[model samples]
Target chain A: MTGNVRLTQVARRWDAIIIGSGAGGGVVAWSLAFQGMEVLVIERGHHVPFSPPDRDHLRNHRLTQYGHNVGPSLDDRRGMTTGDDPTSATWHSPLEWQYNNNAMGVGGGTSVYGAQAWRFKPEDFRMASIYGVPEGSSLADWPISYADLEPHYIEMERELGVAGGRGGTQTWPMPPTAPTVKGQRLAAAAGRLGWDTQAVPLAVNSVPYNDRPACVNCQHCVGFACPVDAKNGSQNTFLPRAMETGNVTLITDAQVVHIESAGEKVTGVRVVQRGKSMVIPTDRVIVAAGAIETARLLLVSQIGNQNDQVGRNLQGHYYASAAGITPESVYDGVGPGPSVATTRWSHGNDGIIGGGMLADDFVLLPIIYAKRALPPHAPTWGDEWKNFVRDNYRRTLQVMGPIQDIPSPTSRVLVSPTETDAVGMPRVVLSGTAHPESVRAQTFLLGKAKQWLAEAGAEQIWGSPSGQYLSAGQHQAGTCRMGEDPRTSVVDPSGKIHGYANIWVADTSVHVTNGGFNPFLTAMATAIRTSSLIS
Target chain B: MPIDAHLVPILRAATARIVPTDDLPGAAELRATEFILGFPEYADSYNAGLAKLPADFDLSTPDAQDSALSQLSSDDPHFFDLLRRQTIEAVLAQPSALWDAMGFVVTA
Candidate 1:
C-alpha cells in the first residue's frame, strides 16, 4: 500500500495527528509510529521533486527575486505591520523578502536547507543567567538545559547521519568531509587569531550511508535540491523511516486550519484539502507548522492562550557576514562551501550579551554573488560589472554567522484582523523589530567576521551590519515559547500547550531562545525528547 | 502573446542596457525577451512601460537609449524594477558559454 493516505483514510480516527511535516513533525512521527501508534501527518505543500535537478538560478530559495523552487505559492500571502494599526499593514507574497518565508514543502526548511546540524553551546541554554537580560529585551533562560537534550542530540545526529568532528563525549556517525579550500584557509586564519575551528556539522553524507550516495560536490547545494541525493533531510530520513513502520500516513497539500476541541482537550483537527474541508479525529494533536504559522494556528483555534502568550517573542537569526578577495583562487568548485566553523565566540565575549558561531559561507551561485556578495562600491551594470564578477568569482571568500537574537515580546506574530488566505482562514500578521541589544550583538559578529577575513590575507573587505527588523526567515523561532510558568509562555517544558491536555507544539515555536548556531538539530532533538514523554 | 509583437524590440533594447554586450553577450543574446515573454502577469506592465518610452527608442544611439531607460526608472519604478531584475536573472541562468565566461561551474 502507498504511504500517502486516500480520502477514505482521512475520516479514520488516528492515535495522533501532527500538523506540518518539517524537522520537528517528521521526528515526532517516527518516535510515535515506531511505538505502534497510528499517526497522521498533514503537510501543507507537496514533496519537491528531486529528479531533473531544478537549478533555476533566479527562482530558487536563495535568490528568490523571481520565484522559488519549493513554495507556499504566490497567493499564500501575509501582512507585515510596524505598529498596532492593522490598516497600515503591507500585504506580501511568499516570494517577497518582507514576508520572511520558510519553505513550505513536505520537509519544510529542512528540504532546502544547508543542513548545518549544530548543537547549541552549553551556555546557550542559560543566556539570561550568564548575561543579564538587556533592557527592552525578553531574553530568558530555557526551561530545559543543553545537558538535558544532549542524549537526544546524539540520537538525532545518528538519525540524520551527521558527519562532523567530535564534541565533548560524543562522536559523529560519519567522518567529516575533507575540508574545502575556503574552509582550510579560514580555519588557518582562526588558528592564527587564537580561536578554535572545527568541521561544520552537516547532515549531508560524505560516504554512501543509509542507502544514499556520497555528495557529488555540485555548486547548487544550499538553495536547490541535492543533485546527488546526498543531503539528508527529514524528507529523506525520518519521514521515510516513519512510513516504513506502516503506522504513519502522510497527507500532502492539506492545511490544518484549526485544532478542534471539546472542553479541555483537542479532539481533532479541521483540515482544508483541495477546497474541501474534513475533520480527522485524534487523541493527540501536535502543532509543528514552524514558528509563524504555528502561532497563527493557535490564535485561529483560540486555544492555549489563557494568558495571551501564544504568539509573542518571535525570533530569527540576525546574520552578520563579511566578504573579501584573496590573492589566490579559493574557489575549487566544491559543493556545500561552508565546511569550517568556529564556535569560540558563541558566548563569553567582553560586553556582548550573546555572540554566535562564525563559519565560511556556502557556494555562491552567480546570481547570488551578483546580488548579495558583490561589494557595495562595485558597479551594478555594464561591462565593468561583468568583468569584475568574472575576475573575482574564483577569488572571493566570505565569513558569516547567525547572531543569537535578543528576544522581544513586541516582535510577534498575530492572526491578521482582516486579511484571509485562499481557504478563508485568517492570514498571519508579523510585526515589530528586534531588540537593540540584538543589533549590537550582530554588529559584534560583523566585526569578528571581518577580522577572520582580514587575517586570511584579504585585500579588500565589505559587509553591512543588520538592522533590527523582525528577523524570522529560515531559522525562525520562539513564537510559542516554552517556560515553567503559563503566565509568560504558551507551552510547558515538555511542549504541551499550557491549558490543553492533548495538544502540543513540537516545532521551533517552542524555542525559549534560539541558539547561536543553526537551529534545525536543536529543533529535531527537542522534538524527539518531547515525543518520548508523550504517552 | 504575453508581450506585444511591436514591443519586443523595445523590450530587447531596454534589457540590453541592464546587461549590455561588450566582449561577452549580455541579456539580449541570452534571450531575456523570450524569458520575459513567459510571464503573462508582466504583459500589462511591459506594454505600459514600453508605450511611455520614446517612439524611436530601439533606433536611438546607445547614449540616447540609456537616457530613455533612466527616465523609465523614475516614471514607473515598479516596471523598471521588474525589467532590471528579470533581465539580469535571465542572462545569468544559462548558455554554457556564459557560465564558462563567468567561471560558474555547474556540475552534474
Candidate 2:
C-alpha cells in the first residue's frame, strides 16, 4: 500500500472496493483478497490497537466515546428537518449505542462485544412461516434459512475461535468455562425458578486456543478491550489474517460520501480522506457500513432506492435492565460479560407471544453503576445521593433483557433536511416507535429479573422506565432487507444486490428481523456466508 | 506499616469502610488505601477539571486545602461521585482471597 495513493488517482479502477471494515465488510474483504482479488476497504473511523486497554472507569463514562469512534449523526437524513420536530429520531454516538447494541472500530462492533456466538435458530429464518405474521407487522421469512447458513456459521466459529458447549436444546457449538461465583449464584437462583440456565457460550479463549491467551476472568470483558488478546475481533482475527495474505488494502479515516452509479451499476465511491474529496472507481462495491449507517449511505448515494426499501424496515434489539441491591456485593469482581444465560425466556410458550434471554447483566462500570443507583425518588445531588451511590455501586446486580423489536416501515433512516455532518453529508433521520409487543416483552423479562434478584436475596429492586426512546443498539437491522422479490428487498439470498451483479451487502442491514440474541454472531455468520458465495 | 502522612486520613476512612479494624487485614494493611489515594492522577477526572488552577496557588497550603476540598465537594459532584466509585472498585479488584477472608464471598 502506498503512503500517498491519492483517492482521485485510484478512481481509475479496481477489482473490488468494500466500504466499512466492520463485520460484514471485513469478512468479504478477507475472502475476496484470499481469492486473489484486488480489494480496498474504506473505513471512516481511525485504526487503533486494543493495547493498554482503557480500563480507567472515568474514561468510559459515556457509551458513545468508548473506542476509536466516528459516524454520521442519525438526524442527518431527509425526513427529519430539525431536532425540535417531534417526529425525528434522536441520535446518540454510535460507540455509545453499542452498549445497548454493537461496538465499532477497526474490528467494528466486534471489538467490544461479548462475542456470544449463537447460530440463528432454524425458526429465526422462517419467522413468518412458523409464527405467521401478526396483524400490522412486517414480519417475513428470511430469503435464506439456517440449513443454508449452518456451514458458514461453523466456518466463522472455527476461524474466530468461538468457545462454548455444543448441542443442548440451544445447539451452542463450543463449551463454556466453569462459572464464576456470580455465575453460580445466578445459576442457583434460576434453578429455583425452574428456568433453564447454562454457562454462556462466549468467543473469548478458554484454554489458550489459536495462540491467544486464555481469559483471565477480569470481569471487565463486555465493553472494555481485553488486555490480553483473548477476545476475537476482526482486528485480531480476520483483518490481520487478510493483511497477511497481502491482497487486502485497509484505508482508515476515509469517510465514504456516496456511491456513484450509472443506471443500475455502481461505478465508484466518493470518499473524503485527509480533508480532500476524491472518487475511487471499482468493478464491484460492497456496502457493509452496518445496518443504520449502511442504510443511511444507500439513501445518500441514491442506490437501491427504486423501491424505496433502502432505508426502510429498520429494527434494533431493544434492551431494558432490571436491577436490585442485595445485602452481599454480588457484583463481586467477576468477569464483565454475562457469565450465565437463560433461554427459558427465549421462546414464548403457553399462549405467550414474545421471547428474550434472561442473562447475568455484567456490563456495569463504576460510573454507570453509580448513576443507576439514583432512583426516581433519590435526589440528583446532595449527601443522600452520594451515600446511595457509595452503598449501591457494589451491591447492585442487574439482568439485561435484549428483546426483539418487530420491524416496521416507519422505523427508518432518512436524511434530515436541515442537519449536515462534518463532511456536509445529510445527517441520518431516525423515525419510528417502540413496538408495543417489544415493550410487553421487556416488561415480562423485567419481572423475571425481579424474581431472580429477589431469590438471590435482594432487599430492594427497581425496573427500568418503560417505553423509553429506544436508542440504535448498533444492532440496527432490516434497512436493506434480503428477500426473494427484488421490488421488496435490497439484496438477494446470495447477498448480491439485485440490479448490480457484482455489488453485495453482507451486514446486519440484510436481516429481516433482529433475532432474540445479540446480532454479532449472526452478522459474522452472514458475512461468512456471503464470502462463500462471492468467492 | 506506616501510612503516608498526606493520605493518612483518607486511607483511614477508606479502610474503615472497606474492611473495618475488627475484620481481617483492612485496607491499610492490604495497602488498598495507598493504592486508591496514589492512583495515578492522570486517571482522575477531577484533575482534568482542575487543569486551570492559578499559577500562584499552593496546593499544600491550609487555605488551598479548604478551597480545593470545598470546590470538589460543591461544584463537582462528579468528582466525589467518581472518588467513592473508584475506591469501591479498587477494593473489589483486590485478590478475592482478601475479601473472602473478610467474609465477602465464601470460598470452598
Candidate 3:
C-alpha cells in the first residue's frame, strides 16, 4: 500500500516498524519476518516503475530530469541544500549544494543502482590502529571487524544471487559473468601494466539462478530498472522474501515526519500518508533511510542525539575518474560497467592513509556521458563540440575509483531549524567536505586510473577531478557511526542506539569508514548483523 | 511565447552566445533554446541569470557575450550554473541526428 495518503486506523501495533525499505530495512524485514515477526516497512517513495528505464531516456535515475525514475515527483520534495555544487566558488554556495538526489522508492537506491557488490577488507576495520590517525581526521577502528561481518556478507551474496568470484582466487555461490569487450580490454591492460585485475562482484546474475533470468548485457544497466528483473536488489530479493513470509506489510510513498518518542523509547512514528498525517504505533523502530535522511530523522525526533553524536561523522567515498578517448571503439552496449576492477590498489599504498578500487566506467546515459566526456578545448555548443562527441563517443574509456574518505565531525547532516519541507519537517542541511588527506589520495588515485586507461590504449587522457566536499552520492555512508564508545558514536557495536535498546540503526550510516568500493552489500551485511542481535 | 514572450528572445539571444553555432546550427538553431528553457522554473532562473548581464553589452557576438557573462559568474554563480547546466542538457538531449552526427548510439 502506498502512503502519503489517507491512513487506515489500525489497533494492532507492529512488532517492528522498519523505516526506508531499501537495502538496509529490506534485509532486516526479511530476517525478522522469516522468524514470523510481524514487520511493517515504511518507504518515502513509491514502488519501482513497472516499465524498464528504456521507457524514458530524457528522464531516469541517471538523468534525473524533472522527477525521480522510481520516486515521488521531484518538485514535491525540497531540501535546504541543492547539491555538492562542485563548480561553485564557495563551500556553502547555493549552486553546489543539491542535498537530496538519492532515490527513495520501495527499493531505495538499490532499485536503480549499478549493483557493484563488495566486501570490506580486513585493513578497513582497523584504520587508526594500523596506519595511525591523520591530522583533522576522525579515523578510528570499527567496533566490529571484517571477520565478524564476513559470514553475513556471504549470506547476502547468496540470497541476492550475486555473480563473480575473486577471479579464481576466491569462490562464490555463482561464477562471474563473462567479461565484456571493455572489460576484456581493461583486464588485458591491467596485466600489461603488471597490476592485478578481477571481474567485479555484481549483485546481477551471470546465469539464470534462483528463478531469476541472466543479464542480457543491455547497456542500460547503471541507472535503469531491469526489464527482466535480473538485476538483484532488495526490491526483487529481500523485500519479496519478506512479503512472502506473510509477516511484512509494505507501505510505500509514506514519508516519515517524526518519531513519537517518550524519552529513550520510541512509541511510534508520525507519518504523512498522501496528504494527511497520522501516527503508526510500533514496539520497536529501525531507521534505515540512508545516511542523510536517517540522521535528519533522528535530529527531528530528538531521541538518538542524547550524546550530541547522532548526525555527526558524516562521510562517503569521493569518486574521481581518468577518462580518455581510446584508439578503438570499446562500447558495445553491454550493461552495468566498469565491469572489471583491481582491489590490489584498494589498500597498502605507501604514504597514503587509504586507497581505492579502480574500475572501468559504467554504461552511461547519453546526455550525461556527452556532458562529462567532452574535451577541454571544444566549444560548449558549436560544430566542434558536436563533431568531437560524434568522433569520440564510442572510443572513450573512463577508469575511475571511489577513493575512501576520512571522516570529520564537521562533515555532517543537520536539520535547518528555519527551513521546512512541504510536510512541515525541517529540511535536511549538509555541510563539510572530505578530509584533505582523502583529497590528496583522490589525486593519487586519479593518476593511477590514468595509468590503467593509458595502458588500455587511451590516447587523449583528460581526468575528472575530486573535491573536498561532503560525499553522499549513490555510495553515501558513515553517518550515525557504530562504536563501543557512546561519546563517539550514535549506535552500539550491535547497532542498538547508545541509550535505547529497542531502537536500532542498520544502514551504511553505521559504517565507520565506507570502504573504497560500493557500499550496498556492506550495508546489507550490517543490516543482517543488526537483525540477528535485535531480539 | 511558450511560457513567457519576453523570456523567449532573451533565452534565444543568451543561449546562442552560450552555445553558438560555427559549423552545425548553433543551440538556438538546433532548437536547444527551447530545450534549455524546457522547464518553467529553469526558464525563470535563466532569465534571472541573464538579468546580471552588462547593459549595452552585445549579445550578438560570442566574444561580447562571453566577456559580459564571465564577470557575473563569480559574483552571482548560482543562476549562471543553472543556465549552463540547463543549456547543455537541452543541447545534449536534442535528437537522434545529434547522436548520429556524433556517431553515438543511445538505445535500450
Candidate 4:
C-alpha cells in the first residue's frame, strides 16, 4: 500500500513525528520504523512523478528562469537583508537565486540532486583543533568524531547503493561507473601536478542494485530526474523501505506550522494540510527540516530558543569554478560528467585555513553552458554569442570545488520583523556574509582549479571569484549546531535538543562544521547514529 | 493574455535577431515562436514587448533589425533580456539542426 495517506486516515498518535523528508529525516524514519515504532513523516511538497519527468530547459532546477522543477512555488517568499542592513531587505521568490532553496517535495533536495555522496575526512570533525578558530568566526569541533560515524557511513552507502572504488571495510557495494573522456583527461592533468585522482563516490547505480536499473549514460543526468530510476536518493531507497515495514506513514503537502509544547517537553506538532490546520499528537518530535526552515520553525513556535541559539552560525559551501577551452574535443556527451576528483587540496594545504576537494563538474546542459561557461569576453547574445557556443560546446571543460566556509554567527536566519509569506507565516530574513578566511580558502581552491585546467592543455582560461554573499544554499548547514553546552548549541552530540527530552534534530541543522565535500552522506550517517540512540 | 495574431511576425523577427542564421539553423528555423507561445507567461510578455516595436520591424533588413534590437535592449532591458533568454532556451530545447551541427546529442 502507498504510504501517502490522508490526515483523517492516519492514527491520532504516532510514536515519532518527523518533519521534512530529505536526507536526514528519511534515514531517521527508516531507522525508527524498522525498530517497530509508528513513524509519521510530514513533507511540505508533493511527490513529483518519475514518468513524464520535467524536461524544460529554462525552468528546470539547473536554470530556474520561469520556475523550478520541484517547488515551494512563488507563493513562498523570503526577506533577504545584506550585511546587517535592515533597510537593504528585499523580498524574493524561491525561484530567485537569493532565496537559495533546496527542493521542497517529499524527497526534498535528494529528489533532484546530482547524488554526489562524498565522505568528509577525519580532519573535518576537528576544525577547531586542527586549524584553530579563525578570528570573528564561530568554528568549533564536532563533539562526535569521524570514527563514531564511520560505521554508519558504510551502512548508509550500501543502503543508498553508492558506486565508487573499493576500499577496506568501507568498500562500496557497486563498482564505479566507467569514466568519461573529460574525467580521464582531468585525471591525467592532476597526475601531472603530482596529485592523485579517484572516482567520485556517487549514490548512483553502475549495475542494478536494490532492483533499480543501471545508469543509461544520458545527457540529462544532473538537475533532472532519472528516466531509468537509476539515481538513488532517499525517495527511492530509505523512504520506500521504511514504508514496507508498515510502520511509516508519509503525508505530503503537509506544512508544519508550530510545535505544541508543555514547558520543556514537546507534545505534538501543528500542521496545515490542504488549508486546514490540526495538531497531531506524538511522543517524540524530530525536526529534520533543512537548516533555514528548521531554525525558522523553532523561532516561529517560540520554543527551542531558551538560550537564543536556534538560528545562529549559518554556513554553506562556497564553490570556486574555473572553465577553459581544451585544445581538442574533451566533452563526449556522456552522462554524469563528474567522475574524477582530487582530494589533495581537501586538507593540509600550506598557509590555508580549511581547503576543499576539486572535482570535474557535472554534465552541463546547452543552456547552462551558454550562460555560465562562456569565455570572459564572449557576448551575451547575437550571432557572435551563438557562433561561440556552437564552436566550444564540445571542447569546453570546467572544474569546481565547494570550499569549507568559516562559519560566522552573524550570518544567520531570523524571522523577519516586518515581512510575511503568502500563508501569513513569518518570513525568514537571511543576513550577513561569510568570514574573510572563507574567501581566502576559495581563492586558493580557484587557483588550483585553474592550474589543473591549464595542465590539461587548455587555452583561454577564465574563472569566477567567490562573491561576498551569504553561502547557505543547496549544501546549507550549521544553523542549530550540536555541543555539550546548551548556551552555545541547540542540540547535543546525539542530536537531542538541549533542555528537551523528546525533541531532537537529525539534519544538517545539528552540524557544528559542514565538511569540505557534499554534506548529504555525512548528514545520513549522523541521522542513523542519532536515531540509534533514541529511546 | 493571448498574443495578438498581427504581432506574431514581430516576435519571430526578434527571436531571429537574437539567434540569427549562419551555416546552421537559427531560432526561427527551430520554431522558437511556437515554443515561446507554449509558455503563457512568456508569450504574454512577448505580446506586450513586440507591440512596442516599429511597425516595419518585420519588413526591416537584418542589420536594421539588429540595430532596432540594440535600441530595445537599452530602452526596455527587462523585456529584451527575457526575449533573448527565452529565444536561446527555445532553440536549445528542441533537437533542431543546430544541435546536430554543434554535436550536442539528446538521449532517453
**What are the per-residue Cα lDDT tens digits for candidate 4 across A1-535?**
2545677776499999999999999999999999999999999888866777677777777777778788777767777776655446787777776457668887788888888898888999999999999899999999999899999998999899899966323468898876899899998988889988888888889899999899888887777888888998889989999989989999988888889999888999988877777889999999999999999999898777888888889888898899999878998877877889888898898988889988888878787887788888988788998888888888998999888889998988888767766555677888778899899999999999999999988898999676787887668898889999999999989999888889889899888988889999999999999999999
Q: Tell me how far the alpha carbon of residue A241 in candidate 4 is from the true structure, in angstroms, after superposition.
A: 1.1
DockQ of each: 0.66, 0.06, 0.34, 0.64
Interface RMSD of 2: 8.1
Residue B66, candidate 3: Cα error in Å is 12
Clashing pairs in 1: none
What would you estimate as the lDDT of candidate 4?
A: 0.85
lDDT minimum window of 10 residues, candidate 1 chain A: A1-10
Ranking by TM-score: 1, 4, 3, 2
CA RMSD of all predictions: 2.0, 7.5, 4.4, 2.3
- For model 2, the stretches where C-alpha displacement exceeds 4 angstroms are A1-12, A56-62, A65-104, A167-178, A350-352, A373-387, A468-471, B1-108
True contacts kept of 4: 0.68
Best by DockQ: 1
Ranking by lDDT: 1, 4, 3, 2
Q: What is the TM-score of candidate 4?
A: 0.95
Residue A414, model 2: Cα distance from true site in angstroms:
0.3
Whole-model lDDT per candidate: 0.86, 0.67, 0.77, 0.85
Tens-digit lDDT string for candidate 2 (A156-190): 88888877765355444345754666677778888
TM-scores, all models, native as reference: 0.96, 0.78, 0.88, 0.95
Candidate 1 Cα outliers beyond 4 Å, as residue runs: A1-4, A85-88, A167-170, B1-5, B47-53, B63-81
Interface RMSD of 1: 1.5
